[model samples]
Target chain A: MSGVADDTAVVVDQVSKKFRLFHERNQTLKSAVMRRRRIVADDFWAVRNVSFEVPQGETFGLIGRNGSSKSTLLKTLARIYVPDEGRVVMNGRVSSMLEVGSGFHPELSGRENIFLNGSILGLTRKQVTARFDEIVDFSGVETFIDQPVKNYSSGMYVRLGVAVAVHTDPDILIVDEILSVGDGAFIEKSRKKFLEFTGQGRTIILVSHSLPQVREMCHQVAWLDGGRLRAVGPTDEVVAAYGASIEAESS
Target chain B: MAASYARELIATRELLLNLTMREVKGQYRRTALGQLWSIINPLATMLVYTLVFAFIFRAEPPPGDPSGLDLYPLWLMCGLLPWMYVTRVITGGVASITNNAGLITKVYFPRMHLPLSVALSTGITFGVELGVLTIALWIFGGFPLPWLPLVVQAMGVLAMFATGIAMLLAILNVHFRDTQHFVSILLPMWMFLTPIIYPISLVEDAAARAGEWILQVYQLNPMLHIVEVFRALLYDNRLPGAVESLAAIGSASVVFAVGYLVFSRHERRLAELL
Candidate 1:
């Protein structure tokens, strides 16, 4: 799938992120002051020195079981978490679809949210207006577009969120376990959109728990285990290796 | 990295505008009074303040120097509106980050924009309040059109100052939940310390009686100069003297700079902590 032309889009160069496991639930200054500084905490490295590269136009997938640090790596790529060690370098505009309705105001109408959410994603008002019709059409929530988003059914809310994020028109997109939430029709629509996105020579980094879904979509995959990359290669090979490792552990 | 604050601000100006408008639109929705609350709330404050000082205490602040108008409500508001602006802006700023922890965590944006938009939205409400006060001043004081530009300038200075404080407190509030609670307690007390209700002459007289150093300590209040500046322009219809202007703008700039520095240092780790 990704053998078209080789140009690197994202490079994760030995990046590591450390998360602190706090000993106390205190988030107030009084306790911190009384304690002379910070509360007791143990350092947990969420992701170790894991490195990988995605060629331009490649649909790359990160597959691992729960607590495998796949989502942390994805977040590091999204610029949500600053890597405590090493760095991540990217060659294109990056947008992360971590959550569907990130900046949506509940009281705002869907039509208003389109503009508000678009602006939050750094799109100008004019750009949001131009793509306004396309977004509404894609989401298939024309009737509720003018109604407050709080009134929308759960499916409608997610579908609209997906539409805005998909239309951000980024060179690189970071997705985190969101595709599994939408209805089947919407998920199919999103799948087709990703294919079209890759056809334009853009790159996508998806973090998913579904192995078959990853095999169906991504050309390459990285399997993370306990904060390190256990395997990285073609989708079928790496997924098979990951499957084997799972069997070995279980048996 | 936020390479340049000005550059980042320029880049995200549209987003700032949208966020500010979001606050403005969301604030008054699902209510009967709607946007009218912006005007009514301040007017109500004026009514209570007038009842307390003008009626009970019989506090007669100096008539406007040139306009020769002696309306207590107008003069009180000229000072009180700016005070309220600072208070509201700071509260919005302190809560800006914590309140939007959802948006901040899910998306990677310039976190500075949250407090900034809060200040700006508070500024909008302040602008509406000032407009009504200006209109009232005109009705009683023969139209203060000549001093309107200075009023606008003072608003800008106060806004910059308030936003700086907001930015500082917002990041701090992220670390200390008590910050928001503490600030709510301090603001009303801060208003009393600033001389919004009674005239500065009352404080001057008290200081004169207590000791001259008390006057010095009392004068150290930045809001004193700032409120006086607002009073001088809007109520008294005069320039805020070169020294007053310099003092007001200077303190505001310093607060803003410190706010910027503190906020920038803690910005990157915000997503993790929150």
Candidate 2:
């Protein structure tokens, strides 16, 4: 695993996000006119005053139990969710493999989806063309490359999705539970790609429930609990603290 | 802030192009006739409307055409070609963000691109429709060469106006699902009011007895100016009057500016709302 460098790539400073929960699903004008108004159930904070920094060219991991806001934090970093308070500052092009095949159209061929998904992930057509063979090679879906993606097996679909995402070559990659899917061989292949990604001196912010995986890949880790950052330090220390807290809670 | 947004949009032009391609290709995919439907759909609409109005209602074609062409169908198509673009933009644009809730929530991109690409895709289909119109002109009106530029200019204005409305509705639909339902109801009403099937002269004749305000408001319809420009170029072989051209371009610019403003303002909350 690589150690943290001095330069900062991503900084989340006092960021927070609030979600509105309505008493009724009142997003339609008909209901609003009929009822004459809306009733608010509550406004809940999804992430609150959470702050962290990932150094340039290092892997940062976020490990948390479910509902701990790890995914929200990762999304905030990806710029998918705008923070309700404070801000996230970043110095490089960010691509979130938040969900693979995000913009894929089932009617489009795999060859076409590769171009579409590549651009959706922020690559230009020329860039996609240059890396076309490698992407096909990585996905191992070459025989069906020209077929519409609807015909691809589920396993083939995900592998192609992952293959395109990693090829985006972003300065900062935000990954959320992507590795947990796919067959064992594909998972191993994806890990090798991540290693190659880190080898190129890029930053990665990983959100996963896999503590040991985090401990192995990331130099620094932050543990989130109930929408707050509970621990941040070297990976082993934070992961160990999170593990102990889990044991204590169960006992 | 809007300038910077425009700059970013331009910088990400590749994404825009690719997405537009996706829209155009995805639209015809899985259908048997495929891309031919683009031309056939409008041609069929033109034939049906021409049958009803020209044959049944006996609406007069333009007064001075020696080409032996039945002027009503040509005139109707001249107006209908751009109308297709306008309606598609409004309905497609309104649903653009909502339909792509999957992508909007999962990934971060300029939300404006969805409506823009949708507008542009329809614009591409509109191009094919124009080709059909040009062929119709060759057979029916003998293909006036000098008047072609005017037709192209009117098409550009229509595109700008439609894209603007699309951008505004796309974001609005995300916040209120009622927008989707409202837009469908609004489009046919909008089409009837715009004078695509009938000539403005009929409305003017009605205005003399009803009141001048009737014609004044009818003239104020931005699409009225666009359809008039199309009729002027393709049917009458002339340029749109200065006032007509000004009205069409000016109204289109205003709509585009307002739509861009509304879309960018609401873009941040889109993922959350979706």
TM-score for each of the candidates? 0.97, 0.96
**Residue-by-residue lDDT tens digits, candidate 2, A7-47:** 88888889999888887786777666777765556989989
Q: Report per-prediction Cα RMSD to one decimal.
A: 2.4, 2.6
i-RMSD of all predictions: 1.0, 0.9
Question: DockQ score of candidate 1?
Answer: 0.78
Question: Residue A165 deviation, candidate 1, in Å?
Answer: 0.5
Can you write out model 2's per-residue Cα lDDT over B1-274, one digit (the tens) per residue? Answer: 8888888888888888989999889888889999999988887998899899888987775652433455677778878988988988888888989899999888888878888888888888988887777777777655556777767777788888998998888887876788878888988999989888877777888999999999987888888888878777776666678888889999999999999998888898888888
Where does the lowest 10-residue lDDT sum fall in candidate 2 chain B? B61-70
